[model samples]
Target chain A: MSLTILGCHSATPRTSAHPTSQYLEINNKRFLIDCGEGTQVQLRKYKIKFSNINHIFISHLHGDHFFGLIGLISTFGLLNRKNDLHIYAPTGLKEIIQLQLKTSNSWPQFDIIYHELKNDQSELIFDDNKVEVYTVPLTHRVYTNGFLFKEKIGERKLNINAIKENPEIEICDYQNLKNGKDFVTKNGTIIENKELTFDPNKPLSYAFCSDTVYKPEIATIIKNVDLLYHESTFLKDRQEIAATTKHSTAEEAGKIAKKANSKQLILGHFSSRYTNLDLFKQEAETVFDNVVLAKEGKIITVDNKTFATELTINQ
Target chain B: MSLTILGCHSATPRTSAHPTSQYLEINNKRFLIDCGEGTQVQLRKYKIKFSNINHIFISHLHGDHFFGLIGLISTFGLLNRKNDLHIYAPTGLKEIIQLQLKTSNSWPQFDIIYHELKNDQSELIFDDNKVEVYTVPLTHRVYTNGFLFKEKIGERKLNINAIKENPEIEICDYQNLKNGKDFVTKNGTIIENKELTFDPNKPLSYAFCSDTVYKPEIATIIKNVDLLYHESTFLKDRQEIAATTKHSTAEEAGKIAKKANSKQLILGHFSSRYTNLDLFKQEAETVFDNVVLAKEGKIITVDNKTFATELTINQ
Candidate 1:
C-alpha cells in the first residue's frame, strides 16, 4: 500500500502551501482523500493519471477540504469519462454538486454515487474481498471523519521444496495445500498442513486521522495500526490556540501515535502561521521516535512484511 | 482604466495556462471578472490585493468561469474581511454558494449582496458617479453576459494659464469654470467655455466580450470603445468547431473589433489544444491593425487621450 501527499496546509491555499488532500493506492484500488481547491492542478503537476481516481473521500464540507470536487468532476466530464464514480462524504455535499450541474445544464456521462455520512460512531463504510474501509469519527468544530484502509488476509503460500520431495503429492492436491489443508496419501498416510506450506505475508493496514483535537478515543479505536497519519496544526507552545480552534498540536499527534502503537507516524495539516516547522518535529519526537513530516509530492509505502514504512519523492 | 489578465484559457486549466478570469481597475474601482478555478492563486501571484476587490462578475455558471468564487469567498472570511462583497452573476449561483456555506456551517461575517442577472439585451448593471458598467448579451451554449466598463465623463480640466489671463474670473467661480460655464466680463465681453477649460479625457471605455460566438450585433453595442477583449478560442482552421461550440475564432474577434471601430483589440481564452499562439495574433491582425494576446499576468492599460493599449508584465 502507498500514500501520496498532495497538500498538507490548513485554512488557506497559497502558491507555496496548499490545503489538505492526499492520494492512496491500496489493494489495486485508487482513492482520493479530501480534494481541496486546486487539487486537479496538483494531480496534473504530480503526473497522476486523472482516470485512475474512481472514488473520492471528503472529510468535511469546509471549502479547504472539498472545494475542488466539483471542478474535478466537471473536468472528468469534459475528458469524456465513461466509468462510474463514487463519492463518500458528509451529508449536504450532494445538494451542492447537484445544484451546480443543474444550473450549468451539464451532467457527466458517467454514473455518480454519493454515500452520505451522518453517523457519529465508527462504522465500516466499504468492503470488498481484497480490502475494507472504515470511518474514524473525529472531534472537530464541524462533522468530520477519518478513513481506515485495511488489506484482507490472503491464501497461504506453497512450500515448493517440500512438495517436490513428496512425489506422491499430485498437482491436483496443490490447491488444498494452499488452503492450509493436510495432504492424504492413498495408503492413509497423512502429512501435516504446516509441513506442506508456509504462512502468507501478514495483512497490512493504514489509518488516516486528521482535522480533530486531541481525542484519545481515536487512538484506542486505531490501536496497533501499521501506519498513522495525524493532524499536527501547531506546536506545543500553541496548545491553547489548538484547543480553541479544535485542532491538534504536534505533541498531541505524537501522543496519539504512541498510544496507537503505530509503527510509523506522519504529521501533516500544518497551520499557515507557523513558518518554522522544525519545532513541530522537535515536539512530536518527544513522545514518538519514528515521525515524518507529510510534505507535498512525497510518497510513503507500507511493505507486506512487518509493515515497514518507506518514503520516496515523486519525480 | 487598466486590465490585468490573471487567466485566459478555455476549458480545463493547466500548469502553463489558466482558465478564464481577469481583473479590471476602472475609475478607482476594483472589479474581478470571470473567476475561474485557481483565480485566487492567480490574484496572489499577480500581487493584486484581494481585499481591494469589492465586485465580482461571473459570465456564466460553467466551471471554468466561476469555480473559484466559493474558495475566494471562504478565504475572505478566513482573512477576516469586514467590507461588503457584491457578486453579479446568474440567478442559480446564490443557491450554490449559500448551500456550500450552510453545509460547512461557516458564514461570512461580512455582507454578501448578490445581483442576479437574467437580461438578454444590453442593460446597465452598475452605475456610480465615476463609472457605469453595462452587460453585453452574447450567444453561447450557456447564459453568458459580457461587461462594458465606461469611465464617466469627468469635470472639464481647468486651464490655469487661461484662468490667470482672465482678470474677471473670480476665485469663487472656479467650480463653475471647471464645470465648463462661460464667463462674462464686467465689460459685457462673452468668453467661450472652451477658452476656460479642456475636455476631460474623452471618457475612456473598455469592453470585455468572451465565451461567446461570432455575432455581429455585439459590434453595435460596443461601438467606438477604447479597448475590446474578445474570446479567440480557435483559429480560422477550426471555425466550424467554433461555430458548433458557440465560440469565436481569432479572425472573428478581429472582424468584431474592426466593425466596432475599437482602437485596440485583445484576444484571449485560447483552447488548450493549441500550444503555439502565433497564429491567433496573425489571424487577428488581418482585420484589425492593433491587436494583442491576453497572456496571463500581462497587464493591459487603456490610456486616456489616444485610447492606445499598453502591455506590460506583472512583477
Candidate 2:
C-alpha cells in the first residue's frame, strides 16, 4: 500500500501551506481521505489520476477536512466520469452534497453512492479481498472519526527449490501448501506446509487522525500500526488552547504515536500562524525517534514496511 | 473602476490554469463575480483584501462558476467576519448554500442576504451611491445572467482658472456649478455652469458574460461598455461543439465585443484541450482590435473616460 499526501496544513490558506488531504494506494486501488479546499488543484499538480480515486473517506464535516469534496465531485461530473464513485463520510455529508447537485440541476453522469457513518464505536466500514477499513471514534467538537486501513495478509510464497524436489506433489496440492495447509502425499506421507512454503509477509496498516483532541484511548485501536498520521494544530505552548478547541499539539501527537507504538509518525494540520514547519518535526521527534513532517505531494508506502517520498511542487 | 481576473479556465483544474472567477472594483468598492473552486486562494494570491467584498454575483449554477462560494463564506465565518454579505445569483443558489450550512451545522457569524434572479429580463440588482449593477439575460443550458457594472456619473470637475476669473461667486454657488447648474449673481448676472466646470465625465461600465451561447441580443444590453469580459470555452475549430454545449468560441466572444462596441474585450475560460492560448487572442483580434486574454491575476483599469493598461500576467 502507498499513501500520497495531497496537502497537509491547517486552518487558513497560505502561500506555502495547504489544508488536509491525502491519497492512499492499496492493492492498486486508490482512496482519498479528508479533501480540504484546493485539493483538486493539488491533485492535478501532483499528477494524480483523478479516475483512479474510487473511494473518498471524509473524517468529519469541518471545512478544513472536506471543503474540497463538492468541488472534486463537480469536477468529476465535468470530466464525464462513468465509473461509480463511493463516499464514506459522516451522516450529514449526503444531504449537503445532494442539495448542491439538486440546486444546480447538474448531477454527475456516474453513480455516486454515499455510506453514512453514524456510529461512534469502532466498526468495519469496508472490507475487500486485499484490505479492511475500520473507524476510530475520535473526540472533537463535531462528529468525527479517524480511519484505519489495514492490508490483509496474503498467501504464503512457495519455496521453488522445495517444490521442485517434490515431483510427486500434485499441482492441486501446491495450492494447499501455498495456503499454509498440511497436505497428505500420494505415498501417505505427511508434508508440513510450513516447511514447504515461507511464512506469509506481515500485513501493513496505516491510521489517519485529524481535527481532534489528544485522546489516549485511541492507542487501543491504532496500536502498532506501520504508519500514523496525526494532526498537530498547535505547539506545546498552546496545549491549553488545544484542549479548549478540541485540537492537538505537536507534543500531544507525539505522545499518541508513542503510546500507539506506531512504527513512524507523520505530523500535519499545522496552524496557519506557523511559518516554519521544522518546529513540528523537532517537537514530535523529542518523543518519537521516527517522525516526519507531512508536506504537500509526499507519498508514503505501506507494503510490508512504510516509506515516504516528496513529489515536486512545481505543478 | 478596476477588473481583477481571479481565475479563468474551462472545465477541470490545472496547475497553470484556474476555473472561472473574477473581482471587479467599481467606485472603490469590491465585488466578486463567478467564484469558482479555489477562488479564495486566488484572492489571497492576488493580495485582494476580502473584507472589502460585500457583494457577490454568480453568473450561473455551473460548478466552475460558483463552487467556491460556500467555502469562501465558510472562511469568512472562520475569520469571524462581522460584515453582512449579499449574494445575487440564480433562483436555487440560496437553498443550496443554506442546506450546506445546515448539514455542516456551522452557521456564518455574519448575515448572508440573497437576491435570487428569476426573470429572464434586464433588472437592476444593486444600486448604491456610486455604482449600479444590472443583470443581463443570457442564453445557456442552465439559468444564467451576465452583469453590467456601471459607475455613476460623478460631480463635474471645476476648471480652477475659470472659477478664479469669477471671484464674486460664493463658495456655495460653486456646488451648483459642480452639479451642472447655472448660477445667477445678485447683480442679475447669469453664468453658464458649462463655462465654469468641465462636462461631466462619461460613466465607465464593464460587462461580464460567461457560460453562455453566442447571443447577439446581449450586445443590446452591454452596448458601448468600457470593458467586456466574455467566456471563450473553445476555438473556432470547435464552433459546432461550442454551439451544441451552449458555450462560445473565441471568435464568437470577439463578435459579441465588436457588436457591442466595447472599448476593450477580454476573452477567457478557455477549454483545457487548448495548450496554446495565442489562438484565442488571434481569433479575437481578427474581429476586435483591443482584445486581451484574461490570464489569472491580470488587472485592468477602467476610468470614466476610457479603459487602459493591458497588464502582464503576474507570477
Candidate 3:
C-alpha cells in the first residue's frame, strides 16, 4: 500500500502550499480523502489516474476538507467515467453533490453510490478480500470521523526445508500445514504447524485522522498501526487556538502517534500562517522518533514496514 | 477598468495551466467572472483584495466556469466578511450553492443575493453610477450568456481655451456644454459643444464571451466596444472540433472582433493540448491587427483606450 500526499496545508490555498487532499493506493485500488480546493490539479500533477479512483472518503464538510469534491466529480463527468463510484462521507454530502449536478445540468453518465456515516462508534464501512475500512469517531468542532484501513492477514508460508525432510508427508498434510494447522501422520503422529511451516504473513494497516483535536481515546482504535496520518493544523505555540478550534498541533499529533505505538507518523494539514515547515518537523520529532512532514506529491509505502519517498510533481 | 486573468485554460486543471476564471475591476468595484477551480489561490498569488469583490458573474454552469465559486464563498465566511455578496448567474445556481451550505452545516454570516438569468434577450443586470452591465445572449451547448461592461459617460471637459475665448456665454449655457449640448450666449452667439469643449469622454466598454460559438448577432449588442475577450479554445487546425463543441477558434474569435469593430481583442481559454500559445496569437493577428493572448495574471486597463500589462503572479 502507498499513500500519496496531494495537498497538506490548512485553511486556504497559497501559491506554495495547498489545503488537505491525499491519495492512498491499496491493492491497486485508489482512494481519495479530504479533497480541498485545487485537488484535481494536484491529482494531475502527481499523474494519478483519475479513473482509478473508485472510492472517496470525506472527513467533514469544512471547505478545506471537501471543497474540491464537486469540481472533481464534474471533471469525472467531462472525462466520461463509466464505472460506479462510491463515496463514504457525512450524511449531507450526497444532497450537496446532487444539487450541484442538477444546477449545472451536467449529471454524470456513471453510477454514483453514496454511503452516509452516522455511527458514533467504530463500524465497518468497506470490506474486500485484501482490505477492510473502519471508522473512528473523533472529537471536533463539527461531526467528524477518521478512517482506518487495515490489510487482512494472508495465508502462512511453507517451510521448504522441513517439507523436504518429511518426504513421506502427504500433500494434503502440507496444505494443512500451510493453513497454519498441525501436520498429522497416518500412524497418529502429529507435528506442530510452527515446526513444519513459516509464520503467517503480517498484515499492514494505516490510520487517517483528519481535522480533529487531540484525543487519547483514538489510540485504542488505531493502536500499533504501520502508519498514521494525523492533521497537525498548528505548531506547539498555538496549542490554545488549536484546542479551541478542535484542531491538533504538531506536538499533539506526535504525542498521539507515540501513544498509539504506530510504526511511523506522517503529519499534514499545516496552517497557512506557517512560512517555514522545518519547525513542525523539529517539534514533532521531539515526541516521536519516526515522524515525517507530509509534503505535496510525497508517497509513503505501508507494508510489513513503512517507507517514504518523494514523487516528482507533474510526473 | 482593469482585467486580471485568474485562469485561462480549456477543460481540466493541470499543474501548468488553470481553467477559466478572471477578475475585472471596473470603476472602483471589483467583479469576478467565471471562477474555475483554484481561483482563490490565484487571487492570492496575484495579491487581489478578495474583500473588495462584491459581485460575481458566472457565464455558465460548466465546472470550468464556476467550480471554485463555492470555495471562494466559503473562504469569505472563514474570513468573516460581513458585506453582502451579489451573484448574477443562471437560474439553478442558488439552489446549488444553498444545498452545499446546508450539507456542510455552514451558513454564511452575510447575505447572498442572486439574480437569475432566465431570458434569452439582452437585459441590464447591474446599473450603478459609474458602470452598467448587460448580458449578451450566446449560442452554446449549455445555457450561457456573455457579459458587457460599459463605463457610464463622464462630465465633459471645459476646453478652457475655447471657454476663455467665449466668456460672454451664459453661465447656465456652460452646464449645457458640459452635458455635450450646444451653447447659446446671452448676446445671441451660438457655439457647438464640440467646438466649445471636447465631447463628453467616450465611455469605454468590454465584452466577455466564453464557451460560445462564433455568433455574428453578438456584434449588434457589443458593437464597437473598446475591448473584446473571446474564448479561443482551439487553433484553426481544429476548427471543426471547435464548431462541434460550440466553441470558437483563434481565427474565429478574431473574425468576431473584426466584424464588431472592437478596438482590441484578447483571446483566451486555450485548450491544454496546445502548449505553445504563440500559434494562437499568430492565428488571431492574421485576422485582427490588435490581438493579444489572455495570459494568466495579465491586467488590462480599459478607459478611453485599452492597455494591458503583466501582473506579478507571486508577491
Give per-model TM-scores. 0.97, 0.96, 0.89
- Give candidate 3's iRMS in Å, 1 decimal: 1.4
Write down the C-alpha DockQ for each prediction: 0.82, 0.68, 0.67
Clashes, model 3: 0
Error of 1 at B180 (Å): 1.3
Best candidate, TM-score: 1
Pitting candidate 1 against candidate 2, the one with the higher DockQ is 1
Query: Could you give me the TM-score of model 3 versus the true structure?
Result: 0.89
For candidate 2, write residues B1-315 as lDDT tens digits: 788898899876666677999998877767999988888889889888889888999999988888888888988988999999999999889987887787777798899999999899999999988899999999988899999999898899888898888878778777878888987768989888888899777888999999899999999999998899999999989989999989999988999999999989999999988889999999999898999889898888765664455574656
Clashing residue pairs, candidate 1?
Answer: none
Q: Local distance difference test, per candidate?
A: 0.91, 0.86, 0.86
Top-down TM-score ranking: 1, 2, 3
lDDT of 1: 0.91
Off by over 4 Å in 3: A27-29, A166-177, A181-192, A282-287, A302-315, B160-196, B236-240, B282-287, B302-315
Q: Candidate 2 versus the native: TM-score?
A: 0.96
- List of chain B TM-scores, one per candidate: 0.96, 0.97, 0.88
lDDT by residue (tens digit), candidate 3, A1-315:
889898888877877688889899876557898899889888887788898888999998887888888888888888899999999998888888887788667789998999999889989999988889999898887789999988887678888888788777777666777778887677888878888877765787889998899998999999998889998989979999998989998899999999999988899988877889888888999999988888988888755533443333432
Q: What local lDDT does model 2 show for residue B31? A: 92
| CA displacement after TM-score superposition, residue B172 of candidate 2 (Å) | 3.8
Q: What fraction of correct interface contacts does each candidate retain?
A: 0.74, 0.64, 0.76
Q: How well does candidate 2 score on lDDT at residue A260?
A: 98
Expressed as tens digits, the lDDT of each residue in B225-275 for candidate 1 is 989999999998998999999999999999999999999999999998788
- For candidate 1 chain B, the 10 contiguous residues with the lowest summed lDDT are B302-311
Docking quality category of candidate 1 according to DockQ thresholds? high
Which digits, one per residue and each the tens of the lDDT, describe model 3 over residues B1-315? Answer: 778888889878877678888888876767899988888888888888889889999999888888888989988988899999999999888888888787667799999999999889999999998899999998888899999999898878888888888767666667777878887767777788888887666777889999899998998999998889999999989989998988999998999999999989999999887989999989998989888888787887665633443334332
